[model samples]
Target: MADQRLERLIRQLQRHTVVGLDTAVFIYHFEAHPRYLPLTRVALSRIQQGHQQGVTSTITLMELTVRPCQLGRRAVAYHYEALLVNFPNLLLVEIDRSVARRGAQLRARFRVRPAEALQVAAALTHGASAFLTNDHGLARLNPIIDIIQLDD
Candidate 1:
């Protein structure tokens, strides 16, 4: 069941344009998250299949920095640096004033979290055609963007 599901996702990601990766996807790039293996693998395959451009908000880097710390400062530093160095294709979209304003409005209107809002904002700012997130709150904001729920 999972294999077929994973394959379908892999195919979809191959044609993705400016994919927006949530914090969960970033974390999986380092140590393994058993539950996220399928999603992560599909994301990676997409990158391999010419979907090289990955859009992520500054907050994702902040959130990702926290998890690697659990492994220790050195490990965190190495992993974070490695990710930045290797993924030149990864675009770090800043959560600037404009994004903040948009996020605030989305929060007021849809009641989504700041982090999720930031992700969507990044995607929109970068002209991303699709958003990759495990966050369910995105369903509410579907009218604004195309969200591909990794958890589903």
Candidate 2:
């Protein structure tokens, strides 16, 4: 079960139909580290249950597969790729022209990396009311979209 603060955050996010996911969410859930795994897994399970729809940049596919691919664990990569593509309530957003342009703008304004900018831009482009990630640093972007940091 989630702690009080996390539970509150999840309840608040449930109010919105669509939420943006960062790559770390996928990594943490699939890899399952001791400290953060529980929260990340529960959060994803909630989305998978169709309670709140999840939207993520297609870049997530690349990010999720890199390690397993490097280690010749093709099956591991395939599992995550399939999950991202086939999940019913989840929408894997692509970095199209509009997203690229907006991502550049976001990059210029905030102290964010290109990947983070792209993820945030994808969420903004598609009208997601909240963005979820373990990166507490993204709280700086709250003015543009609600930043829901799972690790916080």
Which is the leading candidate under lDDT?
2
TM-score of each: 0.84, 0.91
User: For candidate 2, lDDT tens digit of each residue in 1-152?
Assistant: 45775677768687787889999988887888776677777667878898888889889999999999999999989998998999777889988999999999998898788999999999888878899888887888989888888765
User: What does the lDDT come to for candidate 1?
Assistant: 0.75
Question: Model 1 TM-score?
Answer: 0.84
How large is the C-alpha RMSD of every model relative to the true structure? Answer: 2.2, 1.7
User: What tens-digit string does per-residue lDDT give for candidate 1 at 28-110?
Assistant: 65667887776787686666456657788878778888755765786776777567546756777888888888778878888
TM-score of 2: 0.91
Model 1, position 107: C-alpha lDDT score = 86
Q: How many backbone clashes does candidate 2 have?
A: 0
